[model samples]
Target: MERLINIDNGGTLTDICVWDGEEFSFTKTLTTPFDLSQCLFDGMAKASTDIFGEEDLPRLLHSTRHIRYSTTQGTNALVERKGPQIGVLTDSPTLAEELRTGDASAELFDDLVGSRVAVIDADRDLEELSQDIVRQVNRLTTDGAARLVIAMADREKERTVKGVLLRKFPRHLLGSVPILFTWEFTPDAVRGRRVWSGIINSFLHPTMERFLYNAEHRLRDHKVKNPLLIYRNDGASSRVAKSVALKTYSSGPRGGLEGTKALSSAYGLEHVLMIDVGGTTTDVGSVKNSTISTDRRGSIRGVPVSFAMSNVHSSGVGGSSVIALRNGVITVGPESVGAAPGPACFGFGGKQATITDVNLLLGVLDPDTYLDGGFSLDAQRSRAVITEVIAGPLGISLEEALIRMEAAYFERMSTSFADDVVDAETTTVAAFGGAGPMSACGAARIAGVRRVLVPRMAAVFSAFGIGFSDIAQTYEANIAGLSANEFAATKTRLRERATRDMFQEGHEIGECRLEWSVVQEDAEGQLLSEDSYSESDPQPSASAHHAMLTLTARFELPHASIPQAEATEKSPAVSSSTRNVRSTAAQVDEVPVFDLDTQKAGAAGAGPAIVEGPYFTARVPQGWKFDVTVAGDLMLTDTIEN
Candidate 1:
């Protein structure tokens, strides 16, 4: 039997799933952020022992056909502030100061205006900037810079600009530099996404590099040779860690979304909502028209940014959300009962009445059979604390107090989705995490969702998504111009770079595609909203002057009627897409895909279905689905299932 293993490191939990042709198993453990591989190996040891026995562990683990992983390494770096001071090289000298601007209403220290790392104008003489580069490098190095990111003003000029940079700082010297270029991170012409990509690379690569290096070394010692395929927020996988941009900070959540989409198909649910509540927060996303939506200008860490991600709303409420009476107001979490002291029921010396305590008080969770009987809970102690802290403060009966607490927590979680998603469509909500199903019913009622699907082994859903991922890598170049041929040439260059990188890593070339993007806007006129007009309320038709790109991968490219610079001159638009356009592959009537049923027959699909593996289940909801058409993507469809 061809065995498949998937591991997902979430904010609060480390999930694992294994498939052995005939059977599947799932496992969940508390995440160890300070040291990630420790948790991975620990979970691996248990799963291996369970399936292969202690004696056959060696061949079983090492000989597994594939081992996939999705981690929060980049998120950790952002939280820990362990990134490098990037020296931005922009096309225009005036754009350098955009980094220093901060939001006025936020308490973020780094968000202060004029707090930019540093900037260098590429328009200035190379000789002058090279000296500045050395000086900046020295200063950043002294100030504990982990990597160096170089993002130019316009990435389309990569070929012409890279030559000048190569002469100034040779690629061999970059071992000491660890440089990231804007074009290299994202070649498309949007200034914001390009800048965001550079910042993520500058800030996260150092930490990821160290953590992955250690993790890989540990795996090597265990004789596992399969290269770890890391997950991206874009729902893709890559092993060329440093070369790509760190846009997929919420990759773990994306995996859960992928799983939900798969499961929804199996249940034949189209429109659905995906809820993943872990230790820290609850992430809610919708699946419409058998696809998940995308956020183009999404914000992360309170930073106004642009990156393609599943439309998700997150709240500071979750399984580990700490419950407390502050100023006599019954409040539950923004703080958590982490793995260390766990909850009041764990008998681990925690005194705080947490969500777990409330769940125990309501009989939603059994003390004797928590975690599939692996861990035991102390119901009496939990109730004692809840009664003393929550019920006593609210002057209500124990049952009433539990009802109030659970209702409030669910209300808070449900409201997050209420404001974002469009209701009145056939929607199904897939719930996971340690406390997901227990709280999902309440949340679903509030969100007006009709049905809820809790898959088998939902606790380790993320790990199952990892097994369904493919071995992949992405390459981009900075290209800015009005010429389609120039854009086409840039695509060719990026593909070549991808090919060279794969060859160096000893990976066989499977399928390759060329993609490009540029800014564009719709020219249609605008229509008035219902509030403005009386009876004939019509949807707005006026297209916003937004950045747009035309991307095609393995698809025929439409000949441009005008040059790229001219195209943008009249039309102010910038797009972020990764569609391949120049491949020899012929366009067919349609493409083939693997759906939930296909995965059960032992094949991964491009449609919605639940992939029930040993350690986890990937619930692929029909409406929130992904495809391989645009190079590859986890796209959200606007078409709601009626």
Candidate 2:
């Protein structure tokens, strides 16, 4: 059987999903942030053992037709400020002026500068600017900046600066530091966003380069001939060497969005809200009319950039989120214990109380069956931490504190839903991620969502989503004149460039699918209107004129074939055991606990039940009933309403 492997390297866990023609196998291992490739191989090895009954790395790599990877490392590095120090060089004095006056743009500038970086102002004159660039490069490098970004406000100045820098410091030189040009990274009309994008990419370059290159070398060592495909925030995959670091921000959440789109289409749902609760964050996204929503000017950690990506809103509530009592109120995390120590239940020296610990305390998670018994939970350790940190501080019993903490966790999750997905005409809530199933019911109830669907592979759903992605490249060009002819000519040019680039990447022209769109902007460059056009459509008329036009061309290559499991009829539900789980209505009740794998399609059960899987546990509250679809999806609905 042909094999396809996909992996999502998250902040805490590195999840692997493998498709061996007829069946799917999924597993998770701890992420080694110091060397992500370690976890990548470890997870792959575990999946290999499950598939082939042996942990032979080279054989698995050689047999695999494709290996797709996604990671949260870029976002994590930016959030933690762990990347290399960078310096910015601009032709205008406005950056310095803004820094002095503390303008809105200056806030973003400050975010880029951080503590170890510096900014240098240069004059527009070619000669003077060239000298200034040299002086600043020397000064910044002396100050320990390993990377430099050039972001001139004026297009001519930017061109001159890039030319001067390249001529002065050729990349082949032994002492040459890596230099990046803002326009090369992004030519968006928004100067600040373009500059920030360049800076962010520069900061993430070294780490991404190291990890991705190391992974590729490891693949080579294992006799894997296919290029390592990296996931992008635009819901596509690209060769690792061709991918931009900035385009990978929020890529893990983007994979979830892609999977949600597929599920939405297969289940015939008009609108779906997807919530992915991982170890460190809960990402929420919406899909309408079978299309994932996208934002062209998406922001990372509140700093806007011009890269188009899936519109996913992330909150700091997850399974491993640190839970504590702050100022007489229960608080769930924006901070996480992550996988190193994990939750108190992991017994890896973690002392903090987390949502995972609360689930253990409430008897929702089966200690003996967690991770298919690969790892066992330390209930005593969980109890000790919760008793001291949460229960004692709140002057409540363990169960009461557990219930309150759960309420707080779900409240924060529900607020994110209300903020990002409530008004979107959502018909179903698709929950995935290691912690997603555990929190889905309560989050859905609080958000007034009536239907919830948890796929059989809910825990490794993002990695599963990566299995559906295509290899794609996007190109953009700014139209100089706002004429119909200009728009058409620009589109032609960009399409040609895109086709050429993809061809160089080894994709044939016939195998590529091209999509086109135009962005219209006013004199001030504020967005006026954006529309998609086809090759057969007439040129946009001059009467619908705009100050500037930006054209985008997307080239898509087909993805590998993924087997779709057929849905079967519902069967009578059976339980392996009973556990007392705290209901959303604030009552502890003994609920039937069903194993996800053992329960066949057509199996049906009611709320106030626990559905345990290898990686996640779904808590069905009092008012709900869950049925197993033939496709192996657990469909949970409000019993009274449905």
Candidate 3:
């Protein structure tokens, strides 16, 4: 039996889904930040006991074919500022000053300004600066720097510092140190974005490393030999033991985008708007021709990153948010009850009217019988409160307030979704998350989107993405100054490094390919539309390039060195007022021996089929086709013949 474990964490709820070859099992538990993995264990235990009998539970769980995790830890780290302080090393004071503010290095260093300190590398002798380096390290260590980042002036020498730095600081004092070299962090030629990437890695790597270490240990106790995979914002996964564990932060939402890509490609939907409404927020992204669009700087907790990914926008709208009227206007939420207070509808002491309460009032949600009866909801109490608290205050009838609130919620969701899918003309909305379906059709309507694709086990789709993700790693080597041929060589080297890293994680690769694109734009002040490259290429189309240009131009950009006209052929032309363009490439490789089956069971279960384990069900719609496949992905489509 192919048993797979998938975990999804929402604001108020943590959902677990298991695929046991023959059937699917699911459970829901409160999200515990202190020990998020506890819920995973609890969910796994319940599935084991229910499916294999209490005595056989141990053996069956130990035999789990795959285990995947989707966490919000990195998001929380930035939002709550729980990460340790990071130390940055710059090429020189002038270059360091360029990154002092409005850059990722600033965010990573948290801009303490002359506090932890930055070492200026003025192309001078290292022997002369050994003592100064030690002093800085000691000062930073005392000031709470748990990690160090070295961004060099030449960038290519980013990896060369290990030999140079160890000689000065010695391995004992900084030997066990978590050092992030800019070359290794982002070897791509663009120095500015490279700095941003390094900063992000340096800032968040420590927290993620510790969190995953604890999580993997807990998983090991369960006798599961399968390693935990960290998901990247670029919609890929790598083993937890890899040097780039910081990529784990992007896993939770990236999985959803991956699922969207898989679904749209299989179903032949070329353009799609994926709305992942979770407990704390609603994330929106667009897929064109099954490709996820991403911004140059990945957005994590409102911070722009150097990495690229599907462009996603996160809003405070979620199932657990307190719903009320402020300034006589119905406000859905930016504040959540989280796991502790939960929602009033959960019978958990939450008095504020939440979106869940509104769902209960509208008859779309049955509080008395929700989640297959694992938790009973009191509709009458919610109705009473909705009437007394919201309707009366607004001087409107119960039905009117309920209608207004629901309309407002959908409107907010739709407007935000519009911004993401603006470039996609023919797009379908794939809805997931706890309350995704309840408002999906309506939200789509308001957003001017036609067709809503609700996958099987929609609420747990993120978990499914986790289960099927590939073990992958990405590296950027800045060859900004390298020629086209040299750039290709750099790409080859990056692929080799990625493969070696994956092999170290016990993965074997059968086939690997590198994807490279040249980025061209005029000088910093020039508009991309005025550039020759932008007028020539058709892939990104004019609108997409325009958007990209608008975004990139906002920041002070560096000149990209590449052969003229080569960029026009290799990459989608982007407009820039500045004639200067940079050459950059990204390489992705898949590890061998991991199996993924994207097929399904022969038939859809009847009556919100309860597969096993916890109280999770697939509420298949009338005339919908459902199945579980080799990839452990649940597929549901409207099969009523055309």
Candidate 4:
């Protein structure tokens, strides 16, 4: 094992974590939304500077064994409805109508493929069908269709229609809109899963493609030997070309889940509820027995998709999420200011009121020391925005508004945790991200969680989590019939495909640990059963069922050491300094701040205090005890008994 660097790109910040075979070091940079690659390289340069004490990109890149990346931008885009307008074309009218139907997808279907659907007749002559498709494409493009998805009844029909479109609208045609064939993604028999998967993938394609390929090309130019690996929602890393854009959804949160799994194993804890509060969303996930909650067929906004992924819910409320008084009710997000003009406190011309602004005004955040004082936070700007958007409208004092805003934010997070976590008493909440620790105690207490663990690397925790992923990929093919020849043929095809794909990932077929399985799904695409595939009898039961041959190839990598509690005797933690903070509407209190850097392992502290790290801070409010281990792990346990 050598240098493995993990990068988690958020809407507002890009976190970078470097593991040099032994110790871990990390840094972060404000995201450049205008050009994501800019922030990607910016963070890399900072990592290089932090490691070698100088900005040495070449030296850093050459020595690195692997660099894995994950991002929450796709999740943010889907939540904000910020992707390109999409159009859908299908051979079956039933499929086209179902695609536009707003039942399973709700308003998401209307926002993406609504009214932009076209149907073509498969029984028509080839020339006539081609003419119909061309007209539909023209009409859809004219109706502001930025992208297109071709959804048919099956792969056979889908591939046939794709050929017609490619012939008419050749790639050389610069004006031709980009198109996606749904069957190319998955062989799921359900039309809804196949079409929605294509639509979502097409929506996120441009962003992921532009950023990843550009970054990969630049890395190649710099003589970086390994291809850039993308961390997927399936708890593995694969090349950009091999990964699906829809799989990138909520992947950053999945990275946080991986880190939570590590912490659970190290600390010997069970049932961890994760609250990953990033800039735009507070992603909630759960871990039982060191395993993340997962769905065999994942859903996006409740619309089922054709991928198995971790069960993480993205709540709209976050640090930079717009907080306002709507209809006399405090509303938290669904929209965000993002990184460019983050929150009002960021002083990036953002006039929006957000939790960041509230925290700044309440003294929980030091304007001069936030982000390690890298950027100045404008307390006055925060105050002005809050007064205009929240206080003035509600006819309340700014101080009162701040207090209300804090309660609303914590309430939102607590509500999300309540939905995900069943036994709050047994489950320990693990909070991570730049804004995660600020009110972790308050949120957990509200949710009735008795404990919270804020990792030392909480600020860059997601990026650090990506280090646990192994290089892996899966290939599957639908079995045409239950006959022996057909099953053997499908098995041979998937095996050959897996071998070729893994070879591109820099591993030979023999070197990979391969697993073969057969999966059967009902007509509605619900998973029925799975059985290990044996070469002796590759055929499925003669009964009628839709089966698929799946082959998984993985290159297992070494994981970093699991954390162990330090041996030092626990004692009261010494205070580094004190900050004047507004704890209530009536008065300000002197809050003792514990700088973990100056404290020894096993040092303990109690409530009404702040545990401040270089990149993150946690509020140890009343009724909680905070402790640090030798490896810089921070744990907060509720002092209140059950």
Candidate 5:
């Protein structure tokens, strides 16, 4: 494999993993939310500096084969409702009503569409309907509609509306909004799903389009040979232009699952669970029998959307999540003070009490060495916030407040694994991300999980995972019948389209491994049967409820294998130091601090001990034992016999 760079952008930090062909190394940088491209380049500069002992972005980009990117920005935007105002134009009242059904849909609808929805009559005179559309478009836009979605079932009506909108609102017009038709995304017969696909894609489009294209153009200017490949939720990659926005949602977490799945296979783990704790949320997913769980009809933030999404659940609790007393009972987050003013300990004028402050105040994290000593954490700022927001209001001492805050924070994360991690007793928890290792043991124990694994590159594992993905393009067409003529025509069309897309990606049809799959979905959208046929095989018969037939063209890319750590027939490296940490308000103990980088094969130690990775930290509780795997990853097992 040529030199590869995989980037995972989180709300608090951006992780960069570089494969210099000889070895894999990673780095972390603070996220610049105002302009995501800034951090993208900054991380590259840092990686280049690490590789060459000085910053040289041009040389790094020129030598790179592919730069695959994934981010939690879409996930965070949806969670915070921090996207553009979208207006829906639907002629079907049933679909309109269905779009806003129940509490979850209702809440999302109010944010995405609200009163900006314009219901039109299909039977109205062409002139009158066009006039009404113009007025509605103007009204919706006048009332804060940044984008518009058309969700009409009839294709002809949709075309007519499209014609009317384009004529009335030209693309070149200064105030005209980009209009998306539901059919453009999918050919689903399900009314609400089609609309949701459009709504979500439209909602996530602007931010992704703006930042991704900006970064891609900047890379091009730097003489980078390849266009940016977006690591998607479905474990395939496409260039930014060819990628769909909704698929980018939760893509970061999906990358984590990929990394976890790879390590699970290496470790021979049967059932495994991944907890990727970033700044804004704790993304949890399960891997079983070498397969990463995914949903055909994916849910984003508990609201279903028409997409193939990896079954990763994101909770709004993390290291940067606010920890507060509501009615004297602790409550976790739905709101986060992201990178701009990260945690109070970051000392960027943030006053909110978070788990970062709690951990720092308790000395579980060393202020001086945090983030590879990127910057010093402010103990005073952390203490002030914890004392004011938690201790004073609850009438508790500083140490007691820290203890309570940390417990509440860990509990919130542990609860997320209730149903997410199946067979916790047998499952090995893969803990990663900036904050994942810190609470892995405590959270896993609470969730009844006894085994834990932390990658040596745990801090940047998601980016590392992106290296596992291959370039793939999938095309689907709703087949009208099983007649050979109809099937042939559809296959021809899909092949032609795929050929064009792959050509744009600088790959030819000959280079890609293609296969055809047929699926039959009933009236209720449940699958009846499915089968696959190769290019050489005869076409397989579809079931009576045949709905959509999909064709996948995959270009197999080279992947990096896990490195083998040389065995050492020696005792674990002794702790270079010890520090006093408060296990409780009244209890303080000096525990050994073992740096994973210095640990040897078969290195083993028991907690309460602090295990520090390059950019992350793990606090091994008293009952757990930390063992260094031959692969150099840390494995924390509960010695308490759960």
Candidate 6:
């Protein structure tokens, strides 16, 4: 059988999904921060064992047609301030002056400039500045900055400075530091953002390069003929050598959004809200009219970078979020325990009370069946931590404390959705991730969402999405003051570059799909419109000076055809047993629980029911009804009160 393997490495777990042309199987393993490849191989081996009843690594690797990988390592590294120290050199003295004058650009620059870095002024004559550049470079190196970035406001000056630096300090020489030119990556007018983008990419490059190359080498050694593809933040996959560090940021979350888009199209849902509740954070994104929303100017931890990526907003609300009472105010978290010392219940030396502990205390999670019985959870430890940490401080009973913690956690998520997501009432919530289904009902109720769709492979949904992605690349060019002819020429140039790159990656031009679009901005740099570029469009008048024009070219690589779900008769949905589930409606009742794998396609049920799958558990509250679709997706709808 033909096989496809896709994996998503998150903060706490690495999920692997395998498609063998006829059936899908998934497994998870704890993330090994020291060496990510260990978890990658472990998850793959575990899933292969489950599917084929053997643990043969070489056979699995050689037989797989495509293996795609995504991760949140870059995002975690950036948020934790665990990257290389960087020094910046810019020509504009206005950056410092603008800071005093409270300019927004300066504010952005301040956020991007981390500790252990210095910004030196290079806006002087070449002869004079050359000496100063060497001095500043030496100073930064002495201060422990291993990387340098040069960003001049004027593109010409930036290029000149880069050339002078390279001539003075040739990379071939020993002890020469690497330098990045801001304009080389993005030639936009916002010098601050451009500089920040280069800095972030430089910070992430070394680690990403090391791990990806190591994984690729291992794959080749295992006799895998095809190159390993890395998932991008743009919702596509590209060969490792052709991808930049910036494109890998938040890639795991983007995978979830991509999966939601596919599900929306398959179910004919026009509007959907995706909530990915992972170990460290909850990422929320949206799909409108079957199109995933994208942010041309993406940000990492609120630091804007010039990259077109899916619009995903994240909050520190997840299963591993630490719960506490600080200053008599109950707080859920902006802090997480992460993979190591995950939660008090994990028994990995964690002492803090987290949402996982709260769930275990309230019986929302089945301790005996956690991780499909792969690992056992200590419910007693969870209760002890919750009582000592939360109940003791608030002087409340254990049950009340659990209820309060649940309310606080859900409230934070609901408020975040209200602030960032649009039209929640009309949108169907597609909940995924290891912890998403557990909280979907309460979150949906608070967000005023009427429907929820949990995919059969919801636990590894991002990995499933990666399986459906195509090998693609996107290129952008700045066209601020170009006429119609100039714009057309730029588009053609970018297309040629994209086509050549894809060919080098072993994809034929004839078999590839190509698309082009023009992104236009107004005087203030706000996005005005993005439309497909056409040769028949009217020429722009000379008097009409457009602020900026961005040309984008997308090349789609050939991929295996995904099989459609076949029609099958619905059988009676059988409940394994009943469990006492606490509801957000302030009630505790015995809820009928159904196993997703054994449940038939025609199975239908009402609210106050629990659908337990291998990796996730969904709680249907008292006012909702659920029906299993022909495609095996669980569809939940709110019931009207009479």
Q: What TM-score against the true fold does each predicted structure earn?
A: 0.74, 0.91, 0.75, 0.92, 0.94, 0.91
Error at 497, model 2, angstroms: 3.3
Worst 10 residues of 3 by lDDT: 551-560
Off by over 4 Å in 5: 123-144, 163-175, 544-546, 563-570
Error of 4 at 315 (Å): 0.9
lDDT of 4 at 41: 89
Per-residue accuracy of model 2 over 591-632 as CA lDDT, tens digit each: 888987887778998978999876888988888999987676
Worst 10 residues of 2 by lDDT: 542-551
Model 4 C-alpha lDDT per residue in residues 1-642, reported as the tens digit of each score: 568989999998999999987888899899998878889889999889989999998888888888899976687678768889999988776765565466758578888877888888866888998899889988899899999998877777787788888898888862657888888778777788888899999998887887899989989989898889999998899999988888898899888999999888877787998898888888898888988888878998788788888989887777889997889998888688888789998888998998889888888888888877778888989988999998999999988888899999888878878876688777899999999999788888888888899888899988888889988988777774647776777777877888898888999988888887877887777778888876566466634366777778898876786557547788889998898778787778898998887888889988888888868878887778988887777789888874
lDDT of 6 by residue, 1-642 (tens): 658789999988899988887677889899999899889998988987887799887778878877889977777777765677776776665554432233543443454443434454556778887887777777777767777877777778888778777777777751645678888887655655676688889888877888999999888778788888889888778889988898899898888887888888777787988888888889989888779888867766666677777888898888898988999988977798888989999999889998889888777788888888779899998988988998988888888899999888878777656664466566898988888888787777777777888887788888887766777767776776777779778767776887788887677655666665566655434566676655355543322222333333334433323224455565557899999877643668787889988877778888778888878888787788887876677888888532
Tens digit per residue, CA lDDT, model 5, 1-642: 568899999889999999976688689899998888999999999999888999998888888899999987787688778889998887876665787888888899888888888888967888999999888788888889999999887777888898888787787772647889887678776777778888988999988888888988898788776889999999989999899999898899888999888887888788888889888888889889778988766877667777778988778887788887799887888578878798998989997978888888888899999999999999999888878888999898998888887888778888878676667677988999888999889988888889999999899999989989989888887774658877778788999988999888889988998978777778767667667766555555665553677888888888877754455574765787898889988999999999898888788989999998889999999999988887889989998876
> What range of 10 consecutive residues in model 5 has the weakest lDDT sum?
537-546
On TM-score, the candidate that comes out on top is 5
Q: Say which prediction, candidate 1 or candidate 4, comes out ahead on TM-score.
A: 4
Better of 2 and 4 by lDDT: 4
> Residue 211: error of model 6 in Å?
2.0
For model 3, the stretches where C-alpha displacement exceeds 4 angstroms are 20-23, 53-57, 94-97, 100-115, 119-121, 156-164, 174-177, 295-297, 380-389, 395-399, 421-425, 476-499, 509-642
Least lDDT summed over 10 consecutive residues: which range in candidate 6? 540-549
Scored by lDDT, model 5 comes in at: 0.85
Per-residue CA lDDT of model 1 for 318-431, tens digit only, reads: 877887778877777788777767788888777777777776555444455566566788988787888888888878877777767766787867775666546635666667
Candidate 4 has which clashing residue pairs, if any? none
Alpha-carbon shift of residue 396 in model 2 (angstroms): 2.3
Instruction: Give candidate 1's error at residue 368 in angstroms.
Output: 1.9
Q: List the residue pairs that clash in candidate 2.
A: 567-630, 567-631, 568-630, 569-602, 570-602, 571-602, 571-603, 608-620, 608-621
